[model samples]
Structure formats: structure tokens, C-alpha cells
Target chain A: MERKSSDRKARAPSGAAVQKIELTEALYRALFFEWAEHGFSALSLERVAARAGAGKAAIYRRWPGKLQFADEAVNALGLKMAAFGDKGSLEADIRAFHRRLRIVFRHPVVRKILPDIYAEAARSDEMKAISDRVAQTRRDEAKKVIDRAISRGELPEAIDRDIALDFLPSSIYWRMVVIKSSLSEAQLRLHAQGTTAALKSLW
Target chain B: MERKSSDRKARAPSGAAVQKIELTEALYRALFFEWAEHGFSALSLERVAARAGAGKAAIYRRWPGKLQFADEAVNALGLKMAAFGDKGSLEADIRAFHRRLRIVFRHPVVRKILPDIYAEAARSDEMKAISDRVAQTRRDEAKKVIDRAISRGELPEAIDRDIALDFLPSSIYWRMVVIKSSLSEAQLRLHAQGTTAALKSLW
Candidate 1:
């Protein structure tokens, strides 16, 4: 059965198909949950099929193997972090980006899976390439923010773009993901300001 | 056999113990390598035993179960990041700490396992508590640095101590562990300086 049928069935008034869980989404959710629990090397396809209430053939029909499943699953997440709108100033831009990240990390599955994903990327070149492509896109987005600030005369050209990019996400990630702590809205703003100020002061 | 004897035997002239590979050390190595390949969720004790040239009972003898074994293995690594010597300047202290971190992330297994450990910490309370305690010690160490900077007249009392602590390791970690990228010595120094400047610019 085509995966898109699950989406189409959701809109239809069909009796049995309406009750069936969206096969594709259920499988994707199961994939993340299993990855969070068992990890990639030990992930069990039998269990994933069971968890999703689908047969093994159903999964193989969607993807040939685990790595292919992983690639597709991650791409579907569409991490697309490059869409931060022009917030007018570096601090505002940083704060907006931080808010976006905070939302992503708030997802229980995402938080559990993100670090492992990075670890896996470091170990497997295929995963590494996927992760690197995503990261480069985000960094390219960051470079835009830097360019805007420089053009606006809020930041000098001498400010270290590489270091500035690093500063934007590092503190927030350290606080939320690594330390598993939450900060107040005020605290978040102060940090955004701090990053802007820090970035402004250097090359 | 006591784990310490492995340490003792490392210095001994015995043919078997010396040439046979130290059981405890070998097990630790095997643990990291296995974690790197399989991840914690899929980690197999049998494979770890086989790789270490020991039996599962040997692992069971040291620690009761997977979580307990994880606790001991991580502790044996002794993160102890709080011991940065007085470098007479915040910038210098940051540079020194960055160097130490650079060394840790340079290890191949560590580069692979460190992110997973952090990911695991975010999921399990037991692991979270361990990572939290480790983080707290490092923060306390960072506090001492800020205190020194204040005393040395390099920083003001109003500087954002929480954000500064977050700043210390986040950038280097983002580069090495998260992005799986390396920075040159000059780039490392620039980021350290940027962090110091950023921290100094805020309260």
C-alpha cells in the first residue's frame, strides 16, 4: 500500500481506514522511540514492526534497510533551521534562533535522539555526510545574519564570523540539552544579548 | 581479582598479566569501542566480554547491571574538569581549559561515545544525576575562575556568571563533538578570546 494513502484516508469518511493509525507516521514515531531506547546498532526491526503494528514487509517496502530508513526518517524531520527571519539586530536574531532551538529540544524524542544522532554521525561517514549537510545549511543561515549585522553597521567586519556562529548556539545547547536545564525567557534574552555583545567584541 | 591489581600488574614483569592485556583496562577499552559501534541502547555485554577477552561474569562481578556498569565505566573516566590552574587571566584560563577539552575529544572512542553519553543523560534519571554532578563540579570550577577574575580586576561583579559558565565549554564542544570539526590552534584561541569577551560584556 502506498504511504500517501494513510494521509488520504485520514481525510476520507472510510470506516476501517479511519481507525487504522497513519501507517507512515506511526512507523516514523516508532523508529525514533526505538532509536532512543535501543540505539542504531541494537535496534530491532521486529520490535519496530510490532511497535508500529505493521508487518516486517511493510517496513522493507518503505526502505531497503536500517540506514536508508534512518536517512529518510531524519530528512522527514526537516530540521530546516535556516528560516530565521530578519529580526533587525544580532541580539534579536540570536533570540529568535534560540527560541526555535528550545522548541526542538522540548520534544522528548528529539532530545533523547539528538545527541545519539550526533554521536552516530561522528562514527559513520554516511550519517556524517547527512549531518554535515544539515549543519552547513544552518551555518550558511548564520552567515546571513552576520552579513546583515555588518551591513547595518551594528557589527564590525573584524568580528570573527566562525566564532560568532559557534557562540550563537553553544550556550543555549549546553544549558538545555547537555545540562537538561531550562532558562527563563529573561535569561534567554540576556544570553542572546551576551552572544551578540561577545560576537561584536571580536574577530 | 581487584581492579587495582590491573594497575599494579601493568607495572609488573609477569608474562601473562603483562602480555595478556590488563583485564580491567581491556574491558574499559572494549566498553568504549563497543559503545562507539553499537551505542548504549544496543550495547551487548557478550560482545564486550568477547572483545575484552573476559567473561560476562567478570562484568557482573564489577557491576550488577547495565546502568550500574555504565556508572562505574563513566566514573572511571573521571571527567574532573574543574581543576583549571590559575592562569592569571580569564582569557588564559579559557585557553587552558579549551586545550584540556581538545585533548579529551581527540580520542576516537571519546569523540563517538561522548555525545551518546550526553544523550543518554538527557533520557535516564540515573545518568542525568551523574552528568549533573559532573557538570556542577565543572561549574563550580568555572565559578572560581570568575571569582579570580573579579579579584584580579579583570571582570565586574555584575558579569553573567551562569552564562559565562555555559560559554566555557559549549563552543569547543560544538566544534569537536557536535559538528565533528577541528579548529586550528589560532582559531581555538580566537574562540576562547571571544568567549572571555562575551562573558565580560555581560552581568
Candidate 2:
């Protein structure tokens, strides 16, 4: 039976087969739900397999371990960058970013999953590295927005980029996550304006 | 034997009371170490008792359960506002607050324990309430510094108190915890100055 199964898998038409892709999607979706519900430390491959209704061997075949599985599962959820478009002005751009942030935070899966990831990152070096890489990528993308503002003469040339980079996200994260503040659309608008004003004053 | 032991315990002098106090201290210390190493979900009274070389009954006698014990243990470690003495000027006061914050973050125990608490708070409602109460207390204390600054004419009357209250700690927390930035003394000073500048611009 083992030999026949191996032969069938080897003879599969192509590596990117539709059935395999569907199975992978099912597994990833299951893994995400498991993570959102139980968090990282409680997460196990067996649980994920059971949740996905897939075999443990199939999961192990795709990802060697839990960390690798979690990394890919989270990434597949678009955990990296917000879909930010240019709004032509610094204030508008910041508002758009904040609006996107509010939407992201409001996601049912995201709110539950992100805190788990953050907590895990705090405890585990591997998770920290993964989180740091994601943060750095996001920061780089945000830096482009600042650069555009600087070029447009909205922000002065000598403004501190490092502090500027840290401000918006940090402030928003602190309010939304740490303090658990229920900010309305108007309040978000005010926050965006305050942040942009702070940035302008940095010159 | 039980009757005789109870009779003897009832008749014990001040020495037994002192020994019990010492044992309680030892247990709390052990709990801190266990929590630092294992986080809240993994913490158990049995493990803590064994680590402290105390009996489980002794732990039960002192605190009804794990939550109470954990709460007291964390509180005993001073998970509250730091000692921020008034420095008269807005710059001096802000800098003093930052310096104290750096010291708090630098404590070996704090670095190990805060992440666990944060992680636990994310998952458990009971833990979240405890953490929120603690956060609220600290925020109220921080608000005093801002109030003083406003009263001292450093920040204008029209300044948004809410955003200013959120900015310094949130920014510092983002840098210290999220980014894990190892800030130098000079960097902290610059951060303090920039925060105060931002507060000023809020007017």
C-alpha cells in the first residue's frame, strides 16, 4: 500500500496540481483558525491536521514544523503591508493609512491572531525574528510615504526620519492594542491630523 | 497524629509565624522565576511550590488560587509607576520620566515577566482585567506629569490632552518593547526632547 501510494504521488501530473493546491489552502485556513483560537504555544500540528481534516503526513510534507507552518499561515493572511494608495497630500495620505489600519484591526481573525503572534514573539527568538522582518518591511514601505511628503515640501528636509517612522504605527498600536481604546472614525481622523501636525513641527 | 500536630501548631510561638512569612516570600520569588521562564498559561501551583521548597497546602493557605497568587506576586514585584520626582521644567520632567522608564525596562525581571503578562492578558479575560487595571493606574500617574507641564505654561491650553497623554509612553513602549530598540542615554534624551516638542506642537 505504501509503495503504491508513493508511486501515485510521484506520478502526479504536475507539482502545482489543483487538488494539491486546494489541500494546501484548506490546511492553511485550518492552521490560521487554530492559531487564532489557541495561540502559538498551544498550537500543534495534530490539532491543525484534525481541524483541516488532512493527514499529519500531508502537513509535515508541506511544512517541516510548527514555526514554518505559522510563518507561512500568517503571511498568507497579508500580515505585511496595508494597501495604501497615494492621496496626493500628507494629511490625506496619513488619514488613508489610518483608515486602512482601522479596517485591519477590525478584522475578526487579525485582532485575535496578532496579539498571539506578538505574545509569542515576545517569548520566542524565532518568532521575534519573523516579526522583526515583517515590521522592517512594513517600516520600509511607510518610509516611502514619508519620503514622498518630504519631496513634496510638506515635510522639511532635516526632519528626523527614525522618529517619524516610529510615531504613527506606535501611537496607533498603543491606542488600539495596549489601551484597547474604541476610536471612532472622527477620532481616527483627529489622530491622523495630530500625527501629521507633529511631523510638520519636527522641521 | 493529626490531632497532636494541630495542637502543636496552635500552640506554636512567634517563631512559626516568622517562618511562615519567610516561606511566603520564598514562594512569591519562586513564582516570579517560574512566570518569567514559563509564562502564565504554563504556571502551576505545584511547580511553584516545588521550586520554592514549600508545600502546596502552604500556597493554598496564603492565596486561594493561582490568579490571586500570581496577582500578588506580580504586584509585589512593583508592576506600577516608577519613582518620578518633579524636575520643575517640562524638559527636565519629561527627561526624568524617560530615565525612570528606561530603568524599569532595564530590570532583568521586568524584561522577562512583562512579555508573559502581555501574552496572558491577550488570551485570558481575567488576566486582561488585571493588566488593564494596572495599565490604567500607571496611565493616571503619567497623566500627572502632563498636567504639571500644562500648568507650568509649557504646553498650551488648547493642546489635546488625550493624544499627548498617549504619545510619550506609547512611543517609548513601541521602541523598547515592539522594536526592542536598545536606546542609549543620549537617544532617550533626544526622544524625550522630541516628545516634548511634539506636545508643544499639539497646541
Candidate 3:
């Protein structure tokens, strides 16, 4: 019964609509899950193609290989977080950033895929180049907030902006890597509180 | 000529002296280098046997498996770091800890195996138990220094000790995971400075 209904709808959709629906569906399936069953190493061409219901040739045609697929996955993470700052209160901006980070950390794709990509990149020179780009993208995203604070004179002009930017994200990653603890909503709030207090002192 | 000379010495040595030499050689090999090479994975019967020049049976006689081997490795790290928390100043004590950590981070075992273990533990429930214990031990080591400060009354009773302790190690691990950078001597000094300032503010 389910197969009959699916086939009927699949045939009823126009070609462009079907293509759009399939693309959307494939991307959603690819990015939506815990990915715990098979972490990064399992994200081979075969597995991605099978999961996305696209041919291996189709996937390869778009992304050269695993590294490119991983890059696309990272680009997808940009969807999970929102830009913050310009709230006129540094504390509020930091709090929003932390809250958004908490949501991103809880995201299955980010949590499972990110560390694996990091580990793989550490080992493989090829992957490391792509991963470096991913890191820069994230840093630029972060700099937007920190730069806004500096323009508002909430931060010191002499402050090493690169080093200062390292604070919050470093704390979050440390908990993930060393402590192996999930970032709890309350813990994220505590970190935001501590970071806000520390940043205020920096000025 | 070198091999022949060593062969003559091997023949001339008495049984008791040969035993002493064997034990000494084993102990010498067990130091920082061995641990640095294999990491926790190297603790497997086959790898440890190959790396340490012992039979798998002999390794099994000593340690049941990798976890037991890891426990011994961790104990050595504790003993090596035991002489910390001195120099009669809070800044000095924190600086000392970072210096020791710098040495540890440079170890090959720490570089190769630690990230793999962290990644594995994040995905595996079984490994999580061991990983958690290792984390707690490191935290305990950090807390001991904090406890000493409290007794000295240098740190105020009102300080949130856990938050206070989080800064230095978190900063270092952050560099490793996110920045993909090694901790340089200058970076360690900067961490010490930041931590010292943070602790002082709490008082």
C-alpha cells in the first residue's frame, strides 16, 4: 500500500518539481541524522550515495571525494547558527552566541562529523587543506561579532583580536574534546556568564 | 666491530648482571618515549610487545590489556607531575604546570593517540567509562593545586574553584583541537598570565 502511494505521487510530480523534491529530500536525509551509526570514516562515497539515494557518479560529479563531501557538510552547518552583535549590549550578544552554539553543538551532524573531520584532517594532508578553509570560515563568522564590539569601543583597541577571539570557542571545543561532555543548556549559560565577565574585565 | 664488541660483553656478563641489565633496559624504554610512540592503542598485546621488545604472553602476564596498560601510563604521568605546586607564588605554580603540560603535549603518544581516544570515546559507550575516569584524574590533579592555594588563603573562599581551574588546561586543549596549533613556549606563558590575572580578580 505504501509503495503504491509513493509510486503514484512520485510519478504525478512534474520533472522540475521531482528534481527539486529529490534534491531537497536527499540533502535533508544526508544532513539530518545523528550519524552515530557510522561516523566520519563511514562517510565514504558508497555510504553517502546510498543514504542520499543518489548514484555514486552523481555525488562524485559534484564533490570530488570524501573531503569535498565533508566540506559541503561543514558549509551546511552555517545554517544552524545565526549572526549576533549590534544589540548595543556586549553581554546580550555573547549570550545569544552561546545559545546558538548550544543548538549547533546539539546538532547531530555538527557533533558527530566535526570531531571526526578534525581527527582525519590532523592525519591527512589533503583533508587538512580543506579543513583549514572550514576553520577560516568559522573564524570570520566569529570576527564579525568581535569586530562589532571593538567598533563600539566595548573592547580594547590594543587587544590582540585573534587571541581574544579564541576564548569562547576554545572553551566550548575543550569541553567537547577533553571532557567528552555534551554542552548542556545550563553549562552553555554558565560559560556565557563567565566569558561575559572576563570580556568586560578585558576592557 | 660494534656488534662483535657487544657480543663479547654479552658473553662475559654474569647471569645476575645480565638480569640487572635486562631490567634496567626495560625500565629505560618504558619512559616518555615509549608512551609517546604508541599512545593507548599501542598498549595492545601485539604492539606493546613489538615496541617494548617483549612477548605478548609476557605483556599479558603484566597487564591484561590496553586499559590496564593505560592505568600504569597515567600513574607515571601523575608521578612525573607530582612535584608541581611550588615556587611560593601562585603565578609560579601555574607556570610550572603549563611547562610540564608542554612537555607532555610534545610526547608522540599524546599527539597521536589522545585525539583518537577522544573521538572514539565520544562515539562508544564502552570507551566512555575509561575516558571519563582519565578526565576526572586530570581534573583532580588541577584541583589539588587549587586546594593548596585555598589553604594558603591566596585564593578567596568565595571563588568558584571549578571555573577557576578550567582556564589554563581548557586554553591549551582549545589550541590543540580548534586552532590545530601546537602550544609554543610563548603561548604557554600567555596562558599562565591570563590564568593568574583571572585568579587574582576573584580575590
State the DockQ, from 0 to 1, for candidate 3.
0.21
> Each model's TM-score?
0.85, 0.82, 0.69
- Scored on chain A only, each candidate's TM-score is 0.84, 0.82, 0.69
lDDT of 2 by residue, A1-203 (tens): 13333566778857733347678779989988877666677777898899889899988877768887777776776766665767998888888777767776776666666656665676788887768766765676678779889999998898878777766677777777666666687677667776776677565
* lDDT (10s digit) by residue, model 3, range A1-203: 12333565677876432234456347435633524445555445576567777776656545556665555655554633565556676656776776666666666556655665565665667667766766664576667767777788877777655455666566666665445467666656556665655554453
Per-residue accuracy of model 3 over B1-203 as CA lDDT, tens digit each: 12333565677876432233453246335533544343333233465456667666554544455555555555545524334645676767777777766666565555554565566566766556656665664566677667777777777777766566666566666665445667667666666665666565553
Candidate 1 similarity to native, TM-score: 0.85
Best by TM-score: 1
What candidate 1 gets wrong by more than 4 Å, as runs, is A1-21, B1-21, B133-137
Error of 2 at A110 (Å): 2.1
Candidate ordering by lDDT (highest first): 1, 2, 3
DockQ of model 1 vs. true complex: 0.61
Flag regions of model 2 displaced more than 4 Å.
A1-23, A53-58, A83-86, A154-159, A201-203, B1-19, B44-50, B53-61, B83-86, B154-160
Model 1, position B41: C-alpha lDDT score = 71
Report residue A177 deviation for candidate 1 (angstroms).
1.3
